[model samples]
Target: MKDIILNFGPPEELETKRILEVRSLSYLERLERLMAIIEVSHTLNTAKIIQTKKR
Candidate 1:
């Protein structure tokens, strides 16, 4: 994983900077990031389902 730098700025500026940073990454890096995001989303959804079942 690449080192993350925290940035503080207006939303538009931050989004623009993020887009540029992602564009600079290689295809494999982008795919890895996307997979990580999907995994996190799936994990969160599973947790929510478990909680609902417990209630």
Candidate 2:
């Protein structure tokens, strides 16, 4: 079974923690994540455009 960790903190604190975690990643890891984000964004935009044209 996988381990589950829980965090209890304010939004600002959580955001800071997340930022720090991302910063800790290597350049290649960060680039891969950014590319995945861009791919998802492009897919969603294409779907929206197709749906709009079908209306």
Candidate 3:
């Protein structure tokens, strides 16, 4: 059996305009960095599940 996770949230497009409006030194840059971290975490989680099932 497989388990699925659901993510209910707003889309990234909403951040597009807001991100562009941010100044160079603003916290929005950190937001983008955090987004990258989130993506990496998701990839690692998926890889771990696949590796576990193969054992």
Candidate closest to the true structure, highest lDDT? 1
lDDT of 2 by residue, 13-44 (tens): 98898899789998998899899999999999
lDDT (C-alpha, whole model) for all candidates: 0.95, 0.90, 0.72
For model 3, which pairs clash?
none
**Which residue pairs come into collision in candidate 1?**
none
Per-residue alpha-carbon lDDT of model 3 for 1-55, expressed as tens digits?
Answer: 2284554556675465446645444587679767999999999999999999999
TM-score of each: 0.90, 0.79, 0.50
Residue 45 CA displacement from its true place in model 1, Å: 0.5
State the displacement of the C-alpha of residue 6, model 1, in Å, after optimal TM-score superposition.
1.6
How would you encode candidate 1's per-residue C-alpha lDDT over 1-55 as one tens digit per residue?
6597889999999999999999999999999999999999999999999999999
Candidate order by TM-score, decreasing, is 1, 2, 3
Q: At residue 22, what lDDT does model 3 achieve?
A: 54
Stretches of candidate 2 off by over 4 Å are 1-8
Q: Show how many residue pairs clash in every candidate, following the order shown.
A: 0, 0, 0
Stretches of model 3 off by over 4 angstroms after superposition: 1-24
